[model samples]
Target: MPDIFFNFLACPLGSYCPLATLNRNTGICEPYSYQLPPGQPSHTCGGANIWSDVRSSSEVFCSAGSYCPTNTEKNHCSSGNYCPTGSTAEKRCFKLTSCNPNTASQNIHAYGAMLIAALATLLLIIYNCSDQIITVRERRLARSREAAAKVVKEKIQARARWKTAKEAAKKHAVELQGQFSRKFSRKRNITVSDKVTVLNEEYTDTDGNSYPSHEHSTSLVSKKSQSASEVEEIGSSPLMKMINEIEEQTFDSSESFSLEIKERNLKTKKAKGKAIHTHSQIFKYAYAQLEREKAQQQQNNNLTFSGVISMATNTDYKKRLVIEIGFTDLTVTLKGKKKHLLRSVNGKIMPGRITSVMGPSGAGKTTLLSALAGKTVGCTISGSILINGKSEPIRSYRKIVGFVPQDDIVHGNLTVEENLWFSARCRLSADLQKQDKVLIVERVIDFLGLQSVRGSLVGTVEKRGISGGQRKRVNVGLELVMEPSLLFLDEPTSGLDSSSSQLLLRALRREALEGVNICMVVHQPR
Candidate 1:
């Protein structure tokens, strides 16, 4: 008991245990676990009643016979061991006398208690310091967030102010430019030169009339003036003075010969074949040239399209399915089960032949075409389309095929040649041989009989509007320029007249005979 009591009550050398402490100020005992080892028969069997701290359960030292410290069985006291308070050295530790505390033992216990109290105080100080540091970090983060928000708000305001300033400046600049333009126009009136009138003299009207009666009557006038702020309100520029002098001399000379000039003009304008030209005639002739050039350009572009297709067909002489279109167990269902647009449908297309998918207004003919173009078409398609003996999911084969849509895809403002040039540049790969592009474009123009309207606009012109057939040809031409083996046309003759439609189909047949695969959808055809 004495050995166990001392072991439970005493403190380790380097560290103090809170549970085994004795308050030096209060002189109180703190209950703690005192451990025994298995090496010695009894806990207090050693000669000096000493136990190694390394063999004990915890570092706490306590008196013997109290709650023993827990550890592996090997560390417990053995049954036979030497006793400290025994008559012979052979007696075991369990036979030893119990420890009885006295005033001296209590004093030592109080000293250990003071050391433990000091350690606790130090731990509390460290905890306080860490909490303070965390608090400071939190405050800094809050301040940083506030500063960042302020910066973002300021930036937003700056951007808004900049945008407002830019808009105001743009409006002011446009107004200033408009004012400048009006002032400039007022300073310079329309001037007609003799060269303009001479160019117009060659053209004759439908009635075979040579020119208008007032072709030569109009004359140029010159004025001399000064601004309200400049030149003392009297002086004009020297050039203005010279023009004014010439106008005066011309006006005086015209008065003497006015009657003769009028009669001669009347006779010349009325003549069946007059050689003289007027201002209006010059304008008409220039406009005609512009129209003719436009028509020729369109024709040239059409030839380009046809020529390339012919060349591609000649190169690839195989008759295969460039595009195979079908739908198996296909269905398009709306949000609710209320309506279904397309049901399970199937179709196929082969090269060197035309396969027509016929149906009424809402028969999904166009929808199937769109599906073949490698689009979802807002439907579920179970089957696949095969290309060149391989099941090419529709999306994969779209690269090789060419598609011409129903509507005329064109920029009405641009001339015919401009359209073809843009298409060639956009669609043709940069690495394509240049000679091929030239030959293909030229051949297309000649094949489509577009030489006459090669330079014409696709839309209505002043004296001549392009025929519906020609516009359709250009539409077809745009696609043919790419030289795809498989071609798909949607509603090729939907809104065209019989004659125009026939001409277009004939062109398609001619292209097919030349070994180009053609496929098109038509409303009604013989």
Candidate 2:
């Protein structure tokens, strides 16, 4: 709502203010109008310093009565008295009486005219202060509004935190429940099956001894051939026979239940394995499995993969900078969320060799590279990066570590040669003459094979200019002109074709051979 109207005595204190006024002025509270020039911030008075804008961090506090005095013209009260209406030399507010003592009959008429004048003056005072009064009300209300908004924002954040905690708790509970069920819960029940016929073997020749004592004739008892007498005897078995029957029935029930449980578990496992998986997710899971197999086969290989790659450039290069950088237990973590992005990563990059760090997506590849280059200052880094086996300070490390980001940050308008020349002049030593810088740029251009697109503009993505691969090479050349000892490239061939990527990798390999330690993050190796 627009705070165009002002209420009297609604400021910090309920006193007669030269500033505050009534919303609907009718011979009551007076409001002053003070028009501000364009582009000036409007200030509202809240009893000298009672209320202010929330963003107004710098609050000006004043001693008692330092700013505005009560009910004086300096205070802009218009009337000399604090009381709204009265009759004294100051109280005859705006009333004027005629000086006609001789005409006593017209005295009443003159007094009435004087009263009208005073009332008119009061109205004029209130009208003049409308702007100031409205401004003060708005400012005071703004303070309250901002406070309310802050509360709402905090509540929303708290609610979000609570919701996240709830989800985490639910997940933990479900995991615990599943673990307990697997570890402790009985998976199958033992129950008696339907009626089973007991087995019986009979040898009539052995019992009688008179039939045939020579070779006993074996005969199987047919259930139908048993007489009613035999059936009754089987039912009314001995105690031992009854016990055997009961034990057998119980054992059979338990075995059948165990078989049922095993079958159910197999079905469930097959269903879970049949669940759909995205390409990346499947790759991650399969990669974990492959890692297990590799661990088992760890003894097969005697050769070790070195974290450090030593490079000695071909003797042809005039200036060879040997930069050996090693990191021990490098770690990076998020501030507010306490999430560890890079955890205890250790590696080494020495001049004259290309050491590529390959990993799946979201493996902290970029974070690790940026941290080594000091580009990840926003994150909390806890590790020591040693240069040449010594603890080199960040300032010195930054000077030597040349990093090429995934995105090309070159000026789109400048030509390829011009870009390299300017970059050389900026990073090259001041002691080196202009010709020296030019020579460095020329040498970089010649080696990188960017001479074909030297004069051509490195135009915008849509505009005509050099090819994507050439532009990328120019970006590298811009850094190469600096003659940095250690170079870090982050996914340099990310958006390039297979051939372009190989060409880029080859150029880096050549640089490594020349003794510039090159470390790059590549999605895959050729």
Total clashing residue pairs per candidate? 49, 19
RMSD of 1: 29.2
Mark the regions of model 2 whose C-alpha exceeds 4 Å error after superposition: 1-318
User: How accurate locally is residue 301 in candidate 2, as Cα lDDT from 0 to 100?
Assistant: 38
Q: How accurate is candidate 2 locally (lDDT)?
A: 0.58
The model with the greatest TM-score is 2
Computed on alpha carbons, the lDDT of every model, listed in order, comes to: 0.52, 0.58
TM for every model, in the order presented, reads 0.37, 0.39
Candidate 1, residue 132: lDDT: 93
lDDT of 1 by residue, 93-188 (tens): 332222232111112455567789999999999898996986687466445434544554566579879868755655565565567557655544
For residue 343, model 1's alpha carbon misses the true position, in angstroms, by 1.7
Could you list the CA RMSD of all candidates, in the order they appear? 29.2, 30.8
Q: How well does candidate 1 score on lDDT at residue 357?
A: 63
